[model samples]
Target: MLIAMAGLPGTGKTAIAEAIGARLLRPVVSVDPIESAILRAGIDADQPTGLAAYLVAETLAEIVLGAGHGAIVDAVNAVDPAREQWVSLAARSGQTLKFIEVICSDVAVHRNRLEARQRNLPRLSEPTWHAVEQSLDEYAAWSGPSGAVERLTLDSVEPLDVLVERAVEFLGRPTSS
Candidate 1:
């Protein structure tokens, strides 16, 4: 399964993705760290490093899937284009793609989490609460049940272990032969 983790910043997307990756023993391809490296490599922040990072992650994921291992993508798939890219990748790779959209439904909690968070990506500036608020306006609705695979929506307010368990259920835990 190729799990696409989607949500705005501070929405617990990465945390869940990392946990899922650890539980499933799959590679988690995260966009922020990739974009950070691009910036550190002197790519101007003015450039579309975010998009470039997504492309890079897609390629890395293709390799992971090709290696016969599941891959998890950690990204803020806020818009149709970004989300479509993952759909296309899954189709081309013939992998069953799933989306785990994490949301912090409480405005106050979301804002507080955003303000206190520090990802420590040196070349990548953390998003401001204002930016996340803007994203709330722009984050497009999920396209569907993912067309090829089901999409699971989780509220970040739940405990991390609970969220991971739900995600694992959605992914269908492996059974020993």
Candidate 2:
């Protein structure tokens, strides 16, 4: 199985992803760290670092799945292309694809959380509230029928343990494939 975690920044996406990864004992390929590594390697911030990180993550996931193990991808898949790429990858790798879109519906809490976050991704600055808003503006709705693609939409207002429990149960179910 390949779990794709998606949401705007400060939506508690990474926390849930990490927790689910720990609970499921699956390796997580986080795009932020990959982006940080790329920047540290002298890739200019002006370059398409986000895209490069996604491509790198794709390869990592491919390799992990090829080894007959499930993997988790923590990223803000705000567009259809990004989502489609995961769908295609799942098909090619013969892995069950699961998308968990984490959201913080409380605006005040979301802003506070985003501002207070201290995720130490070297060379990768945390996104400002404005950037998160821009991401929301561009975020494509995870709608339409992507045949056999299982999805779980989660609100981060719930307790972390509860969220992880739900995610684990979701993933434990048999694949639609």
Candidate 3:
């Protein structure tokens, strides 16, 4: 299984992805760390590093899936191209693709979280509430071809465990430990 989690910043996508990966004992391939490294190395993260980060993550996902291990990808796959890259990689690797989109329904809470978020990566800059708000406005909802991928839309207000259970059901995997 290859679980690709997508959403805007401060949407709790990474938190959910981390929980799912830990529960399933699968490696989580996060694009943020790669992008951060590139920025720290004096590379602009705007376009060049974005491409590099995705390529690196795609390559790693392919290797992990080829090894018969499930992998989870945590990324801000806001656009079709970014989402398609992961889906295509999973298809080529012969792994089942599970697309999950996390969203925060509470605007105030979401904004607070975004403002309070700590930067774990030294080179990565945290976006201000204004930037996050602008991003929310610019975010394009996923509307890809049906049957090309299996998707699960989740609310950040839900408990992490419940969300994980829902994902397990969507994947047709047993919920039993």
TM, every model: 0.93, 0.94, 0.90
Candidate lDDT scores, in order, read 0.88, 0.89, 0.82
TM-score of 2: 0.94
Candidate 2: list runs displaced more than 4 Å.
Answer: 144-148
Q: Is candidate 2 or candidate 3 better by lDDT?
A: 2
> Over the stretch 1-177, how does candidate 3's per-residue lDDT look in tens digits?
888898878888888888888877989999988889889988865657877988899999889988989899988887888888987887688777878888899988788878888859877877787887777767776667423577789988888899989887777753222
Model 1: CA > 4 A from native: 144-148, 173-177
Question: Could you give candidate 1's per-residue lDDT for residues 36-108 as a string of tens digits?
Answer: 9999999899999999999999999999998888999999988888888888888889887888889999888
User: Lowest summed lDDT over 10 consecutive residues: which window, candidate 1?
Assistant: 141-150
Instruction: Give a tens-digit lDDT track for model 2, residues 1-177.
Output: 999998888999889998988877899999999999999999999999999999999999999999999999999988888888899899899877889989998899999999999988889989899988887779887765442478888998889999999999998998764
